[model samples]
Target: MKIQTKINGHLREDEVEPRLLLVHYLRDVAGLTGTHIGCETSLCGACTVLLNGEAVKSCTLFAVQADGGEITTIEALGNHEKLHPLQEGFWEEHGLQCGFCTPGMILAAYQLLCRNPHPSREEIRKGLEGNLCRCTGYQHIVKAIEYAAQKIGSPDA
Candidate 1:
């Protein structure tokens, strides 16, 4: 199957197997290793990405299912020179230990902030419930998201 999609603001067309998972397409064809594949069953949110402005588990969908859609992987969030607020928050708050789940956690928090810029801590917890992180005990992750919310609400962000 030939699927066309906009990834990280770039339009790309490629031939892929109909059964090819979106996570594989992002990592292999697009060469975006930031979107990791963990627990392909979707129990883990390591493969989360923004699909048409919504956070989705890439491992849960086939590449063909996202044809004509726009996707945002971790690479789109920011770069080393200038990090996204979420990235900065994660760094300052120590939201990650192993760092395996950082990308997905940040993306999920991005979506939550987009929907509710002033999410309460409880809301933040609910927002990130789908993503599992073996490190950090989630307290720091919540603080990171809160920090990002503040940054995103500020004029400089």
Candidate 2:
């Protein structure tokens, strides 16, 4: 089937199979590989992406289901020259180790900050319960989110 969606600010139309997971479609067809694939069972948020401004596991969704929806991956956040506040916070706070879960973590944090603006550490933890990061043990990740929230004028300060 032909699915049309806006991805990373670009309007794209493609023919994808009903079984084609959104992750593969984004990586292969959309050329956005920042969204990694860790556990396809949805246990890991490695393939997290924003579906209509909310974080969702890409592997848990089919490309066809995303038709006409707005999708935002890590690539949508920022680029080499300019980094989003979340990306900058991750870098400044050393939030990533192996970098496997960084993309999803940032996206999830981005969504949380967008909605709440100011979130407590516990709220941040709860918001990111679906995203698992094995490298940093989550302290730096939480700090990174907190830093971003502060920088962006979120209430978490």
Give the best candidate by TM-score: 1
Global lDDT of each model? 0.95, 0.92
The true-structure Cα RMSD of candidate 1 reads 0.7
Q: Ten-residue segment with the worst summed lDDT in candidate 1?
A: 35-44
TM-score of each: 0.98, 0.95
Q: How far is 16's C-alpha from truth in model 2 (Å)?
A: 0.9
Off by over 4 Å in 2: 154-157
Off by over 4 Å in 1: none
- Number of the top candidate by lDDT? 1
lDDT of 2: 0.92
> What range of 10 consecutive residues in model 2 has the weakest lDDT sum?
148-157
For each of the candidates, the C-alpha root-mean-square deviation to the true structure, in angstroms, is 0.7, 2.2
